[model samples]
Target: MGDLGRQLAYWDGAGAAKTFTHPVEHEWLAGVSRAARVLDYGCGYGRVMASLADHGFTELAGVDLAPALVARGRALRPDLAFDVLTDPPAVPRPDGSYDLVLLFAVLTCVPSAAAQRELIAETARLLAPGGLLYVSDLLLQEDERNRARYAAYADAHGTPYGVFETSDGAVCRHHSIDELRSLLGGFELVRERRVEVATMNGHGAQGVQLLVRAR
Candidate 1:
């Protein structure tokens, strides 16, 4: 399976129709108007988008690289738009179109730092002048054994620090705060908070959530 396929497989184990909620994410969403155009980039099965809709967010759309996830999302919310991207790293949105672009848990799955930076640039391009970019990702937190495993992977393959393979054989990266800041330099920092929770994909780690505006 390709990266997208692997991601679909990973989420498949978690079930097709599942919804996730976060207190911090909900608090942030409280300020968003229902009329705002929102794009949930990397939206797996439209969980967050559904949550936004529940919070009365209209004009919401979602895009995912995994076709299966997109299909599932469509099945769950046929009234809402859900697109499957055939092209990797390409969002089929015009420049300065969206008021909010969410990148929750996306960067971690992208193992290459260069690709991550490029994706951020694309996201910036898609945002309106005052648009918001919300990001939540895995923070660099590893136990002793996990740290050694990450180190061994980096040493063996010369991968970047924090880049390692998950138990499912999928590659993911954990980011330090400084690294996150540098990668997100194209945007103006609004707010950032640390969330200590394991991901739904079965990986247990701390995460950092960021809210930024288009520069």
Candidate 2:
């Protein structure tokens, strides 16, 4: 597994400049009640939470591992709640505390499979039974540039096939469809969609959006 300390350090520093571009599909969330308790896990700058609040979601909270990012989020959306996650893979909230959880672009930031699974397990713990988990993340790209980077980085760092280092020094990982589904095994897939989104560094990439119900 990649060192969590290094990852956190990168985000605490250079991550402040990153602009998350994952689009939160309002249609996918239309069925959810406005009163539903929503938690945006790994929410950098509270962009998704702000969008949800604009759409009438009354209960919303966001948390991120990077203190700087969480501080930026609080400044950007003072009306919504934002907190720095003091513990990794374990949210401070009680089990079943949320009716919905958003995991946007978070899996990519976490380069270790075990850490990603632990994060998902925590998401499940936070969600009430039958609650929804909305995830948006990068998929392994077939392009030569990406393939070469993935191969080189994996070879150099002894990480997984899709793991790579960003130009700005952050470690990130893309996921295979099977790998992602395996991580969400505790949930029943409700809907999925493929879309092109700009990377935090502003490169176009293939990404997947998923809505799953907690079992």
Candidate 3:
């Protein structure tokens, strides 16, 4: 199993249910028109997809790296579209297709900077002109425990400070705002705000949310 596959297995065994939502997500999603086609990348268990449906979005779909999560999402929201990616990452959508693409809490899971860049580039390719890309991820905070953990990873693997292991045996990346902005250079940043949200990994840490537009 790949890193994401292992993490997905952990989520499946641990009950992958998203119970929290950041206020920034609501604020950004409010801009999506009712007829807009939305794609929720890394959407686990269709929680956000269902929420979008409730918000009156007519066209909704999601893709996940975890089969169990995708199955759970399909079971939960049969009306919404769901697909599980193969070994290599693929979204299975036409280029410039969606009006909105969500990348909530996804980049943090990917350990490779190259993989993260490729994912972001693929997301950009999926968006139509003037489409929106919404991202929320763990921010590199000043917490002593997390800092110590990150340092240990750096010492052991010679990796960067942002990648660390969570209490639930899952690895995640905590990106600096500058790093995120540089990686998302293809998109035009329309709005960005730091929001404190619950941690997806078992380790509880503060997070940052970003909203951008495809250029």
Candidate 4:
């Protein structure tokens, strides 16, 4: 968690790659523009959800686990609704209520695989049938066919980066594609694709994005 804080400081801090508006417009978002009740889970500084609102996604709400960042997000985009959860609840809304759920660059920050599953299950519970959930992040690829994860860039830049903790308990769980897959056991995967190449803290890797539908 400390490492992630430092990374956030590096990336979203003073002079970094881009705004908090990371490219969440992957293939998953492209397919579901009509969704009304959208929740930007793990929202930070509200750039992405603000952008979505700017694009006419009116029914939007942003939630994050960090209170300080959530306050900053509310300040940045006063028009949008913002909620802060020290530890995120199961679902932000009632079951089968949300038309869309977005966890952009959030899962990797999670402490563990069990937390990931809890997030996935909660999202599933909140999603209305045919509702869509969009997830994007830099994950350790199972197949070494491509050197496109943070670890590869970490190896190149000589900077160390990995999941050093899990949300449930214990310590150190390096995030991988398989772990994410295991987390999303109930969702039906619609598509998965690499969105961009991210180099953080002198380390670079491929960013993968996902679009899934509720079962």
Q: Quick one: best lDDT, which candidate?
A: 2
Q: Give the poorly placed runs of model 1, Cα more than 4 Å off.
A: 1-24, 201-203
Model 3: CA > 4 A from native: 1-8, 15-24, 201-204
Report the candidate with higher lDDT, 2 versus 4: 2
Lowest lDDT 10-residue stretch of candidate 2 = 1-10
Clashes of each: 0, 0, 0, 6
Model 3 C-alpha lDDT per residue in residues 92-189, reported as the tens digit of each score:
77899999998878888787787887788888889999999988887897888878988998889887787888776767788888899998888888
lDDT of 1: 0.78
Model 1: how far residue 126 lies from native, Å: 0.5
TM-scores of the models, in the given order? Answer: 0.88, 0.97, 0.89, 0.72
Q: Model 1, 1-215: lDDT tens per residue?
A: 14333455555554344444333477876677888999998887887788788888888989887667788888878878898766656787789989999987888878777778778888888899989999988888768856876798899889888887766556778888999999988789988898876665545668889999997
- Ordered by lDDT, highest first, the candidates read 2, 3, 1, 4
85 in model 1: Cα distance from truth in Å?
A: 1.1
Regions more than 4 Å wrong, model 4: 1-21, 26-35, 141-162, 165-174, 197-202
- Kindly give the stretch of ten consecutive residues in candidate 4 with the minimal lDDT sum: 164-173
Candidate 1, residue 197: the lDDT equals: 66
lDDT of each model, Cα atoms only? 0.78, 0.90, 0.79, 0.63
**lDDT per residue, candidate 4, 7-109, as tens digits?**
3433234322233434856334555564489988878778778778867677898876566676777777889898865445454467887898888777656
Point to the candidate with the largest TM-score: 2
Please give, for residues 97-132, the per-residue lDDT of candidate 2 as tens digits: 999999999999888887888889889999999999
